[model samples]
Target: MTMLILFELPQVMMMMMRMGMLMMMTTTMMMRRMLLLLLLLLLSLLLLIMSQ
Candidate 1:
């Protein structure tokens, strides 16, 4: 029973770590996309100003 518990502990920890990593990666990707969109908007505004 002790050995089974020990074996299961690492698997559970690894699974948790993997889940955390996936969440972090997806959040970072979403932030990057948002930043890109903001940059595009700023550039368009700048162009509009220059044209005027």
Candidate 2:
């Protein structure tokens, strides 16, 4: 009912915020990993170019 929803609204909002934060943390972690991989690839490419 409307009343129940209104009472639970704050709890729902808190849950949403928590989920959003978790998602952002995971996204940042992925971004860091991707960046490291890219850096390594670039370094390898540079080394190959230098060797040749």
Candidate 3:
């Protein structure tokens, strides 16, 4: 029982780490997309102002 518990502990920690990494990656990707969209909006606004 003790050995089984010890073996499972590392697996659980590894699973948690993987989950955390996935969440971080997903958030980073979303932020990058948002930044890109904001940049595009700014560029369009600048173009409009320049045209006027």
Candidate 3 TM-score versus the reference: 0.90
What are the runs in model 2 whose C-alpha is more than 4 Å off?
none
lDDT for position 32 in model 2: 100
lDDT of 3 by residue, 15-51 (tens): 9999999999999999999999999999999999999
Q: Using alpha carbons, what is the TM-score of model 1?
A: 0.86
Write model 1 residue lDDT over 1-52, tens digit each, in one string: 9999999999999999999999999999999999999999999999999999
Question: Which portions of model 1 miss their true places by more than 4 Å?
Answer: 1-3
> Each prediction's TM-score against the native?
0.86, 0.89, 0.90
**Per-residue alpha-carbon lDDT of model 2 for 9-49, expressed as tens digits?**
99999999999999999999999999999999999999999
2 against 3, candidate with superior TM-score: 3
Give candidate 3's error at residue 20 in angstroms. 0.6
lDDT of 2: 1.00
lDDT of 1 at 29: 100
